[model samples]
Target: MTKTIKTVSFAAAAILVVIICTFLIIRQTHENVLSKETVVKKVEASYEGKVTKATQSKDKKTYDITLENPKGTYFVKADAISADILSMNRVKAVNPSAMTEKEAEHLALERVPGTVKKQTRQSQVATYTIQKEDGKTYEVKVDMQAKTVLSADQISSKDQQKTPITKKEAKTIAERKTGGTADDADLEESEGTLIFEVDVDLPDNKEATVKINAYTGKVANIVYED
Candidate 1:
C-alpha cells in the first residue's frame, strides 16, 4: 500500500510542474504581443503610404488600418501577434469626372430649394445635406459623373417656429467665437434643435466649421480641418 501511494504522489507532482511551465510560457508570450504602433509601422513600411487611421479589433487579435496615398485609400487587416497582413483592399480612388463641390452645391440647391447645411464627400460619393425654409432637412445624393440628383430624402423635420436669432447674428457670433473670417452661414436643424452652420477661415490656411444654437446664440461645436 505504501509503495502504491508514493507512485501516485509522484505522478501528481509531475502534472503540477507541467501546468506551471505552460502558464509561464503563456505569460511571456502575452507580454511580447505586438502593439498597435508597431503593427501600423509594419503596414506602412510594406504598403508605402500614410496611415490615416488604425483600430484594433474588440478581441484584440487583429488591426484595421486605413492608408492613403497617391494610388488611393486602402484598408488593411493585419495579425496582432505576428504583424502579418491578412488582407488588403482599396476603398476609394479619385474620380476624374466627378463634379466639383460648387457644382454639386448649385445642383442640390436647384433641386431642393434650400440652404446647404453640410457636405459628405468621399472620392466619388457625394452628398449634400440641405435645410429648406419649412424646417425640413433633406439629404441629396448626386451622381458623380452625370451631375444629376440621384435621390433626395427628408431626414428630419423640426417644429415650425420663428428663430429668435437672425442669420447675420449667427455669422457674427461664429466669427467672434473663432476669431476667423466667416465665409458662409446656414440655418439648419440638428436633432430637433435649430442651429446655424458657419464656415470660417483662419489666418494660417486652417478652416473651421462652427455650429451655433439658433435660438440662444450659443456656440454648440467647432471642428477644425487642415
Candidate 2:
C-alpha cells in the first residue's frame, strides 16, 4: 500500500479500537440495573397512579415513566448507570417544590460535613445520609414542599479497625444474613472499639442494621428497624 493509504488505514483501525473500548467499559461498568417493570411498579406505588406510558432507554439501562393520577400527569426518568446507582432523574410536571438529588446534596452539604451516601424519597419527603470523618453517619430529611431540611440526626457510626474483612465482604455477609441488598455501609470507631455497620434493606420492605466486628469479621449484633 502507498504511504498515505497505510496512514489512513492505521487511523481508522485506531478509531475502531477506541470505540470498542468505550463500549466495553460502559458495559462492564453497568452490567446490572433495576428492571423497568420493577421501577414502574415502585413509581406507581409511590405516585398512587397508573403508569400509562413507559419507555426504556435505547441502552436498556434507564427508563422514562409517565404516571397519570387524579392530580395530573407526571414524568420521571430513572437513571440506571454506573456503580448500580438507582435514582430518579429529571422529574417534571409533578411537585414543583421537590428537589433533585443534586439539589438535595447541595442543601445537605451546606449544613453538614461529609459525603452523601444514599438518597430516597418517601411520603413526599426526601431522606438522605452523610458520612462524616468521625465515623458517624447522619440521616437528614428534607421536606418536598418547602425544600428545607426537616431533621438531621446522627444515626450510626463506629470505630472500625483496619481488619480481617473488607467492607465489600462485610456487605456480602450482611446481605446473606438479611436476604436483602446493602447500602450506607460504614466502618468507623466508637470510643475505643472498631466495627462495621451495614444497612441491609430486605426484600419485604424491612430494614435491618447489622454490626460486624472489624477485627473478627463476625456479627457483633443485629437489629431490625420498626
Candidate 3:
C-alpha cells in the first residue's frame, strides 16, 4: 500500500510539470506571431528610414524589407518569431551622377515652356506644375537621374476638380509643421480614407513623413526619423 501511494504521487507531479511546460510553449508561440504592421514599424525603427518594400518568407517565419533614405538603399531581414535583426546590408548608394533639382527644372521648362508653380520629387522623377503666361497650367515629369523629359500634359479644367487639398498644399503644411524641405508627395488610401503623404528632409540627415487627411486637410500622422 505504501509503494502504490508513492507511485501515484510521482505520476501526478510529472503530469503537473508537463502541463506547465505545454502552457509556456503555447504562450510563446502566440506572442511571437507579430502582425505585419508591427513588423514594419520595427523595421523602420531599426533602419531609421522608409520601408519601400516588404515581403515575408514562405513559412511566414521571416520578413525582408527594403529601406531607402538620402544615404542609400538597404536590404533588411528579421526573424518573425523573435523579431530579431537577422541581417542588414546596404544595396545601393545615392547616385552621384543624378541631376540636380535645378537641372531637372531646366529640362521640365524646356518641355513645357512655362513658369514652375510647384515642383516635387517622387522616386527618380521630378514633377513640375508649370503655368503659362496665358494662365494655362501643365504638368511635366522629368527623369532626374537620366536628365530626360518623361511627359508634359496640359492640366484640364476637369483635372482641377481635385480633393479638398492639393499635393502642393500638403507639402506646405508638412514643411511648416516640421521646418524641413518637403521632398516627395503622394496620395494614398489607408483604411478606406484618402491621405496625402509628404516626405520631408530635415537637417542632420533626419527625415519626417507627414500624412494629412484629404477631406479635411488635417494632419493625420507624422513619422520622424533620426
Candidate 4:
C-alpha cells in the first residue's frame, strides 16, 4: 500500500513540472511576436521633408531623397513598409516664399549680370557676391520660389558715373580689361564708375568675402568673416 502511494505522488509531481514548462514556452513565444509587430508598424509611417528627387533602390526596398536649402540628402529603407507623402519638393512647410537652391541660383544669374563671384543659399534665398572685370563688387539677392530678383546693388565705392549702364555692356567691358574671365565679375551701378571685385579669403580663416564694382566689372575687396 505504501509503495502504491509513493508511485502516485511521483506521477503527480511529473505532471506539474510539464505544465509549468509548457506555460513558460508559450509566454516567451507571444512576447517575441508582439515585439516584431511593433517594429513593423513604425517602419510604415511616412517621413516628410524637402524632396528634390526620389529614386527607389534596385531592390525596391529603399528610397533616397535630396533636400534643398542646406543641400542635404538622405536614404530611407522602405521594404515591407508604407508611407504617405503630404507634399513633395517643397522647401518649407507653410511659407511658399521658401525657395530651393537651384531656383535661387537661376534667379541670381538672370538678375545680377556679372559672373557669380560667390553664391550661397540661405533660408531659401540665393545671396550672390559678384565681381566685374572693371574692379567692382556687388551684392545681389534672388528669391528662388518667386523667381524674382530681390536686390541688386554695387558695393560702396568712390567712382560716380551716372550714365545708365546696361548689365550686358558692363560685363563685356569688365571682362576684357580685367585680364580675367568674365565669369568672375558682378557688373552693377555704384557711385558712378563701373567696378569689379573678386572673392578674397582673409588670413585668419578659409572663409571668403566677395568684392565687386556696382557700375563696372571690377573686383576691389573681399573680406572674409567667420
Top lDDT hit: 3
Candidate achieving higher lDDT, 1 or 2: 1
Please state the error at residue 117 of candidate 3 in Å: 2.1
In angstroms, the error of model 4 at 144 is: 2.2
Between 3 and 4, whose TM-score is larger?
A: 3
Count clashing residue pairs per candidate.
0, 8, 0, 46
Which candidate, 2 or 4, has the higher lDDT? Answer: 2
**What lDDT does candidate 1 reach at residue 45?**
90
lDDT of each: 0.84, 0.74, 0.86, 0.53
For 85-115, candidate 1 gives per-residue lDDT tens digits of 9999999985556688888889888889998
Best by TM-score: 1
Per-residue lDDT tens digits for candidate 2, residues 34-111, read: 666777777766667788887878877777777676556766676654213245443445545567767877887777
By how many angstroms RMSD does model 4 differ from the true structure?
A: 14.9
| Ten contiguous residues minimizing lDDT sum, candidate 4 | 78-87
Model 2 residue 72 CA deviation (Å) reads 14
Instruction: Indicate the worst ten consecutive residues by lDDT in candidate 3.
Output: 157-166
Instruction: Supply candidate 1's per-residue lDDT for 164.
Output: 45
True-vs-predicted CA distance for residue 74, candidate 3, Å: 26
Determine which window of 10 residues in candidate 1 has minimal summed lDDT.
156-165
lDDT of 1: 0.84
* Residue 196 in candidate 2, Cα distance off native in Å: 15
Which ranking of candidates, highest TM-score first?
1, 3, 2, 4
